[model samples]
Every structure is written in structure tokens, then in C-alpha cells.
Target: MIRDKIRELLKKNAEAETNFSLEKPERAEFGDYAANLALVLAKERKENPRKIAEDLIGKIKGNREADIFEKIEIAGPGFINFFLNKDAVLEEFKKLSKLKTLLKFKTPKSKIQIEFISVNPTGELHIGHGRGAFYGEALSQVLKLTDYKVEKEYFINDSKESSQIKELGKTVLDEGTSYLTENLKSQISKLKTKIKNLKLEKPKNLYGEAGYLIAEEIQKDNKKFIEKELGIKFNNWISEEKNLRQKNYFNKILEILKNKNLVYKKQGAFWLKTSQFGDDEDRVIVRTSGEPTYFLSDIAYHFQKIERGYKKIIEIWGADHQGHQKRLFAVKKALDWQVDMEILISQVVTIKKGEEIKKMSKRKGEVILLKDLLAEVGKDAARWFYLQKSLDTHMEFDIELAKKREEKNPVYYVQYGHARMASILRKAKSGKISPPATFTFAEDAEILLIKKILEVFDVLEDAIKDYQVHRILSYIYELVYVFSVFYRDIRVLDSKQERERLFLVKETKKILANLLRLIGVAAPERM
Candidate 1:
């Protein structure tokens, strides 16, 4: 609201005709805030910036528009900086105190289905898979926290893909396929024929794991290793094989698109006229081989989601799927649906041992399973490490850093800060210590910690809207570092201000616990 008022005043002034940007001053020696509007205006008007800044400062002295700023100054290169009363900074703490009883953001009031990490049922999850699992799960948590109607979905790609088709064909033929042996193939064929002929309940791969038996066996220990390491879970596991084949849904969707003339047969295969809807090129829905492309069944699955009544569909995909976004949007446009879709692209992860990079592959034995990372550094450490960097940036999983498991570890640092707060609280409870009636800031360290801690709410909202989970991670790590330094420099318990310390410690724990829970990290009592 305050920011809006500033923008309005800047827009009203004809001479100060540029956009206003409020920034904190470089140092305490200067004003607490700065704006570079004069510099922008000078460039536009072709005048000296300093003279323009001076004119604005003089005008601002009596202007009610500048009331939000306690002090404003013209800094180097015609920058206007403002300093507000300390109460402005303290206001955040008051908000934090009330956070226990209040909600900050309004609800979207629409159900959201986010499908992610639907890694094929073919292999164990790797570090790359962990990125999607963490980001998607964290994004879901943030939305829920902000009061969005959200559901987590895992689209199990068990059918129609090259990988799945190969696996299924191999399984049906029983040509050394993993789970579908000769006996299993015969059983499945008999069941398939039975389903076609009988009106009774048809048998199926009720044991989905049975299909992945061979792949799992080859990477048996590695699969367990990855799961234990990543903490990945799905609320809904929708099997494409089951969903695509459900009453011939794929054909049913194609029929609808065909009737709409949104689909066309070209080059001996069916193609979706995605280019008509601004896609780079028309996408093939069915290959010349008579097999439906993954996009064809994807349309069916998306239609299934729409049928389920989700107004919003969010997908978390790896960077490699960047080009896949246009086609998905094309489906939405072709169907004439108002459903909103947001796809977050998670960058790749690199495994490093000491200083050497260790390449990982799911097919090759060279893969470093998620479980391996967990075994080496524990879950909290691994997650913190994985999420510490922005999803848009490639993450290097440093084995040496994780192996240290020291206070230097990003996760351990945050947990230790939380643990330290817990320790302070325990001391207060044990000693029955209390402070003055009125809450007040004392030491510089105490104020610094409070300031940093209060920013989590803002960061949470920012990450949710921008789809930037890494910002939350960065904020938490910074908060922890600040708190740790403050904790070391100042005594929190057994002092005249012990009650206030107890309050801060309690609030700190609340934030740490909530944030850690959201990011799939553990805020341990002791570390």
C-alpha cells in the first residue's frame, strides 16, 4: 500500500516524469533509502541529473507525498533515497507476533492439480528426479500455505512412450523381460483376451511393481538407496496404461479433436495443428508406425484431469522438456478450456566427488541413486543441498561438502540455528526465567535476528508467485546464518531479558519448523 502511494505521486509530477524506484542506501552514512527517478528523468529530458534531483528534493520537503519517508536525500548520480522511522522496520515483528492468529494472503478458491516427478516406473529415481520431487512438493506446500486448493499428482508414464512400449512389448513377448516372464506373459495374454470376451472382472497388472521387477532387480539396491535418500512420495499415482486404455479414452479424445477439425492427417500420420495456436510447428499425435505419440495420450490424460474438475493444472518438468510446454498449451487452446497451466522447469544436477564430476545415468550402473546421497549426508543435508540453488540454475552435488556433515553444511547450519533456539527455550523453561512486561529490542544481534526471521513470510509469497523455490532456500539459509551469529554473540537465556528471548526463540522455532516441513527438511531438536 505504501509503495502504491509512492508510485502515484511520481506519476502525477510532470517534471519528475520517470518511474520511481525506492532502494536502501548503500551505508548508514547516507540516507536509509534512495530512488533513481531523477537520473531516469534527466535522461529523458536531456538535462543535468543532479540539478533535477535537487529540484525534486526541495519540492519533496513540504510534499505530503513524501510522508512515508522520514528522511530523503539526493545521492550520487542524482539518486533520491529515503529513510523511514525505525518503527517501519519494527512493524514486521508486530506482524510476526500476530501471524499465529492471522492469515496474510487470500485464497485462490480453485482446485489445483500439480503432477510432477511422474518418472517412468522403469527405473529408480536419480538426483535429477529428486529436483522435480522437491520443487513440485515445495511449490504445492507453498500454495497450500497461501490458501490455494491444491492436490499432488504423480502421472505414472507406464504406457505409450518409447520406453514403456518397448518394455511392454518385451514383457508381452517374454523375451527376457524383467517382471513379465513366460508364465506372466501367458497370464497377461489370457487376461487380455478374457477382458475382450467376458463381461466379468478382467485381470490386470494389479501388481504394477511386477512390471518393473526386472529393472528393479538389476538396480535393486540402488532403488532402495534413492527412495531412502530423496523422500519422494505421490498423493495420486495415475497409471497411463490404465488411464489411456480406460474405455479407449485415447481414441475418444482423437475423435473429439477430429470432429473439431483441430487434428489433421499428414505425412501418413495424424498431427495436431499446434502451429495454428502459436506453437513452433504442428506436433505429431500419431507416428507413421500406427502408434500414438506420447503427446496424443498426454491430451487424453489432460482431458481426464479436466473431467476430474481441476480448474488449474501445474506441471514441474525437467529442463529437457522445455520444448514440450508449447504442445501442452496447444492442447488447452484446442479444447477451448479456461484451465490455467504453469510448468516449472527444473535445471539439471551434477554429482561431484571431491573435485571430480561423477556422471549419473539411470540406465547405466554409473548412476548415483538418491539413496546414496542420503546415506552419505543424511536426508536433511541432501535436501538442503539440492534445494539451496535456484531451480533455473544447474546444481552441483558436492560429495565432499556433504561428507563433511559439519556446521558448514547448508542444512546443518539452518538446523543448528533452530537447535540453538530450542536449547535457549529449554533453558528458559528449566530456569523459570521471565523478563519485563513490555516487548522491546535490546542488543544489536537480537534485532538483527528478529529482522531476518520476520522476512520468511514475504519470501514465501514471492517464491509461490514467481515459482522460485530456491529464493525461500536462500532466505532461510541467510536467516540461519544471521541467527547463528547473533546466538553466538549474545546470551539468550538466564538474563534480565530472558522472557523476551523466550518469545523470540519460540517464534523462531515456529518459523523454522514450518519452513523445514515445507521444504522436506527436518528441524532437529539437536544436531
Candidate 2:
């Protein structure tokens, strides 16, 4: 938000549509914040950037917002560095009447639908699914802060025609054991009588019916586990079989494509001219054997998402599905997808302990379950570990580090910072936190702590720009690092500055709790 104000001032002074960089300086002595407006202007005017920077600094000093800055200096190559007045920055934070006034930021209403972790109903959720699960949850939390109406949905791959459900049927009917884990065996055991009735009812394709029954039970248990144990929730549970096929969406889309002359028959198979819409090649929508390809069902499902009126749709999928993204984008172009659609591929995760790396061999049915991981290292640590890295990077979960209870573990260190702040507030017998009308103290440590707290807003704004939830987690770590330095250098309890320091501690606690909530992690009063 402060960055926006700074940009507005730069634009007003430049007297033209402007684009410039404003960010924190790499080193502390450079200043609290730095910008490159002078360099951008120099490019246009063909003038010395240092001279432009000096003139711009004078203009900024004339504006009312200039009062918030303690010093505005022109640095190397016309980079403008801004140092904020401690009292002015604190006043900006204090004007908010309540925590929500600052925390629940408002933006223009935009309807968004985020879909992730749509695993088949064949087995328990693996550690691979954990990435998308926490990623989607954290993404929804940040979106809500910016006043986006985000619908977190899970698509159930329960279509009887799906190869997975068919294979699961063989396991259910005792014909073969595929994806037959102990938990799935329990589900099959519970549905034995129904499986028997299905055997008696439809002898020809009993695998499909039997698979459907067991899949329903498995999905029920999976949903319950997400709610109770993992603390994740979904707004909708859309089924591939019930929601798309039962409604005849696939058939309708086929008709729409055919009428538009986008479909043609070649070599006894129905082909879609996907290459015309920017795909690398044409693709088959239906096989020569008269079975629809997976692409047909995907088209139908996305069409429904568009019909439901989401202005923005985001899919967080596993790395294995990355190859399908270009074709999906082609489909969007062919069908004139009006909304903003993005697909993020979360790379593979491997468990690491010291020197050895344990990668999942799902083909051999050797995998780690998400629930099991949570049981091994508590839920907060599990969630934090799942989201520590960017989605594009292959995550190596350091189990040994995550298991540590000391300051070496980043999550533990952050949570400990919140606990220490809470302890400081409790020592002062503070009531519900309220920002004072003004901050009368000015110390290097205290001012730096406030700057870190303000960066919380910057991190959230960045996440909204790119939907990168990891930014929020990263900022909490830096915030705690700054808090540790502040608490170590300055005395808060039984000191001359007890009153002002207590106020700082209480504000830090609130800031930590808000950021932790955004990342779907717990902020403990005591650890």
C-alpha cells in the first residue's frame, strides 16, 4: 500500500504514464525503500539520471506524503532511497480502527474459482498431493483478504469410464489387487454386501458398479480426513461421473464443436484441429473404438466452470500433468474462454534425511501418505514444510530439519517468535491489542520491527499479483528474524520503555497471527 502511494507521487511529478521499480534496498545503509524513477525518466529525456533524481526528490518533498519520509536521497545512478519517519509510519498504521481494517484488505470484487488436488478415488492422498492441497488452501486465504470471492473446489475423478476406477474395480471384486492399500481394503470390506448385490445385479460390467460403490466410500473418508485432521475445507465436491457425464455435458460440447466445424473424422477417429488454436498438434477427442478420450471430459468440465460464471479459474495440478497445459490453453482459445485461466504445475516432492533422498515410486505402489507425514511431524510443521518452496521447484522435504524442535527449524523459529511476543504481552497484563494514537519511542530496533510488520502487506500484495502463496510463508520467517533481533537488543519488560515496547510486542503478535492464518499454519500462544 505504501508502494502504491509512492508510485502515485512519482506519476504526478513525471506528468506522464510511468512504470518504475520501487523496492527495499539490499543493504540496510542504502535506505528502508529504494526506487529507480529517475533512470526511467532519463531514458525518455536523454538527461543525466542523477540530475533527474535530485529534481524528483524536491517534488516529492513538496507533497503531503513527503511528511512520512525522514530523508529522500539520490544514490548511485539515480536510484532514489527513502527512509521513513518512525512516528509517521506508526501513525499510518494506527489510523486503522480494528485489526480487520488493516488485515482484511478490500479490492474490486472479482469472482474466482481455484481447483486443486483432484486425485482419483483409488488410494489415500500421497505426499505429492500435499503440495497442491496446502497451496490451494493458502491461495484461497490470501484471495479472501483482497476481497476476492474464491471458491475452493475439488473435482472427483469418479467416472466409471475412467481407467483408474476400472482398475480399482478389479481390486474391489477380488479379481486383482491394484491400489489396494490397507485403508482401501477397509473401505472395500465395509462395502462387501453391496459389492455382492452389484455382482448379482450386473454380472457383465460389475467392475464399474463395484468400483463406484467403493469409490463413494473412499471419497467420504478422504473428505472427512481433510476436514478433521488436515484442517482443510472445500466449497464444492464436483464429480466427473455425476456432475459432468450425468448432465450430458460431454455430449453437448461435442455437438458444439462439430457445429462450429472444429471436429473432423480421420482414420476412423474424431479429431479436433487443436493445432489451429496454437496447440503443437491435432488431438483425438474420441478413439476409433468409440470411447471418448480424456480430453473430451476435460473440455466438458471446464465449460461448466465457465458457465458457472467464475471470472478467474486456476488449476493447481501435479507435475505429471504439465504436458497437458498447452493443449488446455489451446482449448481455451478455440472455445473463446473469456475468463483468466491459469494452470500451475507443482513439481515432484522427495523426502530427504541428511545425505539420502527418498523419492516416491508410485508405480511400484510405494509412496508416503500425507496423513502419515502429519502424524510423524505435527500438522503445523507438515503444512509449513509442504509450502516452503515455489510451485515450480522440485521440493525436497527435509524430514530431519522439520522434526527439530529448536530454532534451526524455520517453522519452529517463527512459531517461537509469536510465543515470545505473547509472553511479553502477558507479562504486561495487556488486554485486546489496540494501536496507540501515536508511537513516542524512536529506536533503530523498534523502527526496523515496524518495517517488517509493514512488509506483511507487501507480501500479500505480491501473492495476489502472481498467486504465489509461498511469499506469505517466506515473509513470516523474515518478520520473526527481525523480531528476534529487536527483542535481543532492546529490553521490553521492566525497562524504561516498557509501555511503548509492550505495544510493539502486542502488534507483532497480531501481525504474526494474521500471516500464519494466511499460510494455513497455526500460531501458538506458547510452544
lDDT for each residue of candidate 2 in 1-527, tens digit (9 for 90 to 100): 67778878888987868778888787988887899989999999999999999888888899987887889888999999988877767765564324653456677688899999888888789899999988888888888887778899999988887767888899998999888888888888888888888888876557777788888888888898888987888999999999998889889999999998999999999999899998999999988977678888899999999999988999999999988988889989998989999999999999987899989988887799888888888888989988989989999999889999999999999999999887788878445645555577678888888877877777777788888788778888998999999999998888876777787887778888878877878888997
lDDT of each: 0.70, 0.85
lDDT for 205 in candidate 1 is 38
lDDT for residue 326 in candidate 1, whole number 0-100? 89
Would you list the clashing residue pairs of candidate 1?
33-81, 33-82, 34-81, 35-80, 225-371, 226-371
- Model 1 Cα lDDT, one tens digit per residue, 310-380: 98888889877898988889778878877888888888798888779976654454666665576777777
User: Each model's TM-score, in the order given?
Assistant: 0.80, 0.95
Alpha-carbon error at 207 in model 1, in Å?
17
Total clashing pairs for each candidate: 6, 0
In candidate 1, which residue ranges exceed 4 Å CA deviation? 1-70, 74-82, 101-103, 160-163, 171-233, 362-365, 429-436
List pairs with backbone clashes in candidate 2. none
